[model samples]
Target: MIRTVVVAGALLLGIGVVAAQQDALKSAQAIMKANGKSLGGVLGPMNKGEKPYDQAAVNEALNTLDDTAKKLPTMFPESIKGMKAEGDYSPSSKIWEDKAGFTASIATFAKTVTDAKASVKDLNTLKAAFPAIGKSCGGCHETFRVKNS
Candidate 1:
């Protein structure tokens, strides 16, 4: 009876750990998506001249992106996959297979965001630099993300 109880306790503990990891993964992904949306909110209006460009908001968004980029590599530890999160979005297995490449891509994106934050004094500068940022995001997604089916 003691052996059975111990086994059951171990199983429950394992399930709890898995659930916690999944929760962490979900939180991380949500933060990333929110940061992306925040950046988009800043960029879209400036791009279309729908509103006067807010340099402070742009800088804040870029900084958030940079911060997120720094955390990103560690966020997708190999164990994150196969965990059940409520969201359908997940990292591609290619991330683990080409960890170096994934890290490099994120590093490049972070650098671009830093540069943009430093140099974007006006709309024209943003226009010139934003596409590179967008490309960096696209490149990473193309190589390392799998959209929900």
Candidate 2:
């Protein structure tokens, strides 16, 4: 029957939409994880004095952070807004509830990175500069990211 065909078509369309949203979520999460690992891997050891400070590495990590900040706003689409946070890198639903706050966090992160790039010249400066960068990341994560339970 024509009605049966239409029903099946509607169901297929719904499934396709869900699948697309899942793909988008996974892609966004991967980008975040890579950025986090890249930055954290470099700065974390340096900050702890476990690894010698390397300006080139710091610069590269900051560049990654800069690019990630620009991509942050677009990663949260409407389709993924209400999805349950399942694991690491999952965005909180509060992101939609507080769009301006979320945006402000990104701006803060970008500015901190710019400052770090300008100031981090030596080990002492790297140590001095890292707290703000870490704070920016932690603050945003606290407000916008859903930690795994």
Regions of candidate 2 where Cα sits further than 4 Å from its true position: none
TM-score of each: 0.89, 0.87
Cα deviation of 136 in candidate 2 (Å)?
0.7
Model 1 poorest 10 in a row by lDDT = 81-90
**Per-residue lDDT for 71-149 in model 1, tens only?**
8868877777655445666778888889899989989998888888888899999888888888887788889877776
Q: In model 2, how large is the Cα lDDT of residue 64?
A: 85
List the pairs of residues colliding in candidate 1. Answer: none
Question: CA shift at 26, candidate 1, in angstroms?
Answer: 0.7
